[model samples]
Target: MVRSTAPLLALCACLPDPLGRCQTNTDCERGPAGSFCAENVCQGPPRGSIEALPARFFARSETVHVRTIVDRSHGEPAVHVLLGSGAVAAAREPDGAFGADLPLRFAPAGSEGPVPFAVEVKDDLGHLTLLPGSIQIDDAPPRVSVDLASIPSPAAVRGSSVPLRVVVQDLTPVTLVWTAGGAQGAAMQQPDGSFIAAIDTSKAPAGAPSLDVAFTATDAVGNASAAHASIPLTRLKFVTRHDQPIASIVVSDVIWAIAQSEIWILHRDGTSLTKGSTDATPVAEAATDGHHVFFARSDDKVCRMGSDGSIQLCCGPFTPLTGGPILLGSNPIVSTRHTATTSSRLVAVLDSNGICNQMSWLTTVDFAAAMPAVGVDGIVYSGASQAIVAAKFDGSVWTGGHPTSETPSYRGQAAIQGNSVLVSTTSATIDTFASVPLNSDAPTPTTVQAAVAGTVISSPTLAEDGTVTIATNDKRIVALKTDGNIRWNATLLDNATASPTHGAGGLVYVGTAGGEIIALSGDDGSAIWSQKVGAPVRGPLAPGCDGLLYAATDASVVALVIDAAGLADSDWPRAGHDIRGSGDARRPLRSASGACLE
Candidate 1:
């Protein structure tokens, strides 16, 4: 056996000498982590290889667990982080991989760029390996805002599309999503580096006040930002509020109103007519003949205004008239104090030359209470003592009073239906109608009493089919046939202070003391729709030339959009026979035989 200085070295004989000198590969003690023979000497554990796993980019705010797979071919390997001071060994992961964690604080202070980093693997014999600059870190979040100039003036309209634009300031690619009015969608990138989206408002409520929009912008590296905006929305095409209690409204080419003192003129669609007022404040309701407006001024004079708002005629300064002016042919007629008795009244016809034809007949009876109704002939009918009498423009008695027993509703205007004159009256708590022959000189009294559900509170409105509709103090709407028979009676939420008016599609509209407007079907008295106005609606309700319903509430004159075209084609659709309050029933009509004749 070969002699050796140490016994441990003597057993192998291929071991390196104490001075670390070797003759061949077997001359050195070799293992996974032991010294290896190289160039006839014990060199070292061979340099090991290493790799950092799951290579990906990270934000500067993130902490990275750097997992490393180290080469174990030579010896038990170890992983380390190369710090500025010295190398620190990495701990063994649960899966037997060696790695270390790099915290967010590892990035140098005030560093915005990607942090340079490295990893090292070593064997038990002091060999080394490294992985450098294989990781990148992002620094900042995305900045997002809305381009205010791109928003529309009225940000949203019902049943229309609203567009939005977004601007983002970021170095990385970005994705944008938007939400508005319970809807969400992704925004499309524009060529100008902006994001664009269109919000659909077709399904929004008719009374919605506004539309809210929000945006979330996220960059490719997961940096996110948010933005928000509110767009004022228009609810409907026709909504206006005249800040005063309205007494009366007339709808023609223009909408006319007599508030406390001022006359408000609006387009048929509720837009401002821009027509300035020059005439004196009107005391009575305004009237129109489809060309000129007629109203009784506060100065106790009758004035005529052109549709363009110019004063055409102002006659009188006469005795106070109980009702407004009415048109008979080309002249205006009014009811004034009778020269005979303090309790009775007379009709004054204003001629083309402003001459007052103080026609007097029933100075012996109670005459001239409500506004008079004109027939197809030149006859004018005025209410009298328990009767309705006829008079010609030439101051001749066409017929004596038609007798009745019911008390005449001084506030209820009269109507001329077909062959007789229809008038509303009240007997104790019951309301009835008195009819008289239109063409008969020796008129016979025909009192048609209506058995209504409640006391009549409004004038009798006659439809084209001769159906009469009225409201009562008992919160009911009752319809009556020509012979005074009950047609239908519908319950109401409150007492209708305003007269029931007829509209298109056999619908009747009434305003309640509870500040609500209700639409009911004339055929069967079924509810159609209702809206609140926040104040008592005591004045008349006028349906406009457009699909709008104009109401005079205690607080304001409001215009609301509806589904009807205009007033119904009837004998007496609204108050005073027409929107003009003309009270003229001489217009051409289609008779029962379909004869279009007057």
Candidate 2:
């Protein structure tokens, strides 16, 4: 009996038939107010639809207002937003449209992209209409990064502009800005979607070790991301003073020099601290033990001066000196010869305070042309005629002579590296560079020899890689591999007046008689840059702790700015190796941070 009544009710419900039009729920329109879809026929309240809605949603907004166009044909209607969580009731606005506050509570955290939602409009007659899945949601921030490889070099010069490359990934467009060293600029986008920015270092401080560049990328909707890149920077500054400087050494940020027959102590800024008479014939540069300076006065005496400019003590007039004094521990040792050709050569050692210990002397010594080098084992090495001599102070014993070449010529300063002593000798007949082993235990401690194009006037310097860098009197700079093979050679613009010194970043610096201080790449022996002083540069380019290159020329002493914070981190970076010109390669004086010490 119930089945018979259902058949009659079904026929009455299809008064306005349209059965073929609605095959699925999607085929029906989302009507509002009174009208709804049933069997493809509108029934109950009058029809209405959602006219406007936000095209996208943001999770940070917390709530969204949805507007609907409802029909008044079915009296007053109620509007609601149906999210994945639950329904949110809507109220009529003053403009006549129904509005609903859709909270983000219905959205899962970290959810993004198109979030399907439904809108419903119901009338008093209980007829409903729906619109589903039309808006999108965005919750992700842009990905940001910096392309470090795109930076020009590890170091940037002051008052220069350097370019940086940036990368970002996001669904929306982003804007970028960069800041560094108190400078800021907008990042420009390239055709390939990468961004580029140029950093101006005009106002950046010259002494800072590096400049840090930061970038921030923001999307259209206020979601932001950040990235950073750091680049080392170099600022060039030159300080010149006409102090009549000759040879100089840097100790603890102070400059000590033999200037115009006087011992001058100066600040790195060229300000004179004190000056004292040196008996009119100050024969050598000053040496220090980090607190006091030792010098040779014309009276054939070894005098010690405190760093405060006062003479500490004076040792008795020793034999006529030939080269500058050097230190082994606290003792100031000097080289003396009665005459150039005479075999009457003496190596005298004096205690810390001016006390002479006639304990060590060599009668067979034929020549001592340059300052001697001391080994870590307290062995003093010098170049004698045709040989390299080693003398130890412990027992007043000499290691005898290790002959270098068959030719008898005076050798300049010696640079000791590891167990070997490197010496260069030049004469009318032959010019030789030798690396002789100090250890006598080897069956045949073969002397490694490398031929040079011309006379080597200064000691050889060792690169960090153990390559030997030397300057020749013939205006040439040469580098030799560890095996004594020629690595590279560079012909200088003029004859080198002093030894070549190593600087940070694999650079070699040398001064020339032409008044030009030149810098060369240690790796390839290529010219980097050269600055000309008004006078002949007479000595090594001294690297100071204040990031300045101190050069003593014939006319004036000048401080040239460099890109290094301190000296090069190499075995034998400079002539005489350290700032003191100690010539001891095995134990170059250095601070705990590896910076050269006085």
Candidate 3:
């Protein structure tokens, strides 16, 4: 029995020890259906194998839905699945399968790269299974932003350079898309993720409206973002400032200006006509008749210079005219005074040699003031009694006086058409526009008065169709029909200080104190186009023979090509357009239909 017991013990020892203390798998026996001996201990099948499902590549600020299957074979049902800082409860199926819908949200401050995931499975004994493996977590996308504060002003002038700036946050490439004045192009990105696009408006189409700029950013992962801005373009083709303020401007073959009390001529292309100062300082506005420039000097002398800057004529010692001299066939008709304190004014028609050939005494009671208008029949001027007076060139008084009830404070020069004399008057409380018949015998002239609401400060421009265009102090431009009826009124950008210029195709051009040149329709007074020229326009706009419109600002002269038809050909050349100061240039100077001929 001892021997048999000894052999049995030896056989039991040779077999597997039930306590299961083994150094290798060869010393241990498989215990259960889903159990295995590991590290000399019997363990259940891995708590669960977590298999990550497909997911979309997300951005840093976006959330991703993680659909994973947790398999629990020998271990108990999985309670939850953990991925990064996000977790989800595992739903156990009847087939012992565990599935979890995990929402993994990557925080801005979270780690980027591969993320480790773990699953918690509980056995029947409350033991937990933690499975760990690396899954890629790519939530990094290039950041992009627009710097609107650094953007250029919405208003830009033509032929000017506009700068654009953009800011990007990543190393991703960037591009600038720009469309200005019907022009389109693309710009490359800089090293610092910033893009700078300089747009030159001179290269834009003739009538290009505004500038539209956009920026596009693309990340390394194909992510994209965009931003946009707009800028309104102006009609100013070019601007060149002078050392001194520009007092007046006249356009002929060359552009002339009174700056620094001297005459400066500029070519059509904005180049200097003369290498240096052309003439002596002038006391008043300058006038050009396409060949010779006439000006009044500080010494009360009226002088004429050739277009090439050669002095032609200088007549002086006589009383200086209140307004500039009126040129009629190479002669100057001026309102002069024999003595400094003389109450009566004389209308002197001077010869080409500056010698007064004819003189007519104007009847006066109070302050002698008049802007004379010369026509084919006679010379018409406003008398001191606010009446219309007429005289012939031979100093013969034709119409002594045609009195009106209201005071005639003529703001702009008078305009004559056919048998009618059109004048704009502004009193203390009323703005009156009158169309008076030219009758020497009629004691009371037939006057048709068109009352305006605001003060009329600019001269009335008469069209060939007998329509009238005028600018008022209230920043308004109005058109009047033949019978003095209101056609249309449009608001101006600022105070309309300069006279409205009538262009071809029934268009009117007006300048404002706000540095804007506005074009209005002659029929309805609707705004056609507006350009901010960057300086106050104080002088009249002259339509050139070319398609360009010339204007005088505080510091420079600007040329703009506003219309395709170009400026019309009119006998009226400078301000107060004609020699009669009629301001109407719709016809030739000798035409009987409203022609101011002497």
In terms of lDDT, the poorest run of 10 residues in model 1 is: 427-436
Q: How does candidate 2 score on lDDT? A: 0.67
In model 3, residue pairs whose N, Cα or C atoms come closer than 3 Å (at least 3 residues apart or on different chains), thus clashing, are 418-594
Q: Using Cα atoms with residue i matched to residue i, what is each candidate's TM-score against the true structure?
A: 0.55, 0.59, 0.55
Location of the lowest summed lDDT over 10 successive residues in candidate 2: 427-436
- Write model 1 residue lDDT over 163-266, tens digit each, in one string: 78888877667899988777888989999999887766643443455567789898776877889876666533444676656677766677776666566777
Ranking by lDDT: 2, 1, 3
Q: Write the per-residue lDDT of candidate 3 for residues 1-598, one digit (tens) a residue.
A: 3335787888987776677665665554456544555557655554456565454343444444433355544444546778667677877666656766555552334334566676676665455667775544444444445567655564576567777766666443334465555566665577775766677766655445865665565654355666676656766667877777776676666777767666777888787776224345664355666776766665556676676766666665345455555554455544543247433354443553445443334433332344555543344444333544444444333344343444554444556555555555554121323334444343443343434434544555666566766677777777777655677778876888666777766677888889888877767888877777788886777665455778778888788865533333332223466322222233254335632232
Which of the two, 1 or 3, has more lDDT? 1
Instruction: Tally clashing residue pairs in candidate 1.
Output: 3
lDDT of 2 by residue, 126-158 (tens): 766676645555667778988879775746655
Q: Write down the lDDT of every candidate, Cα atoms only.
A: 0.64, 0.67, 0.58
Off by over 4 Å in 1: 1-244, 269-281, 297-300, 306-312, 317-320, 337-348, 351-365, 376-378, 394-411, 428-456, 588-598
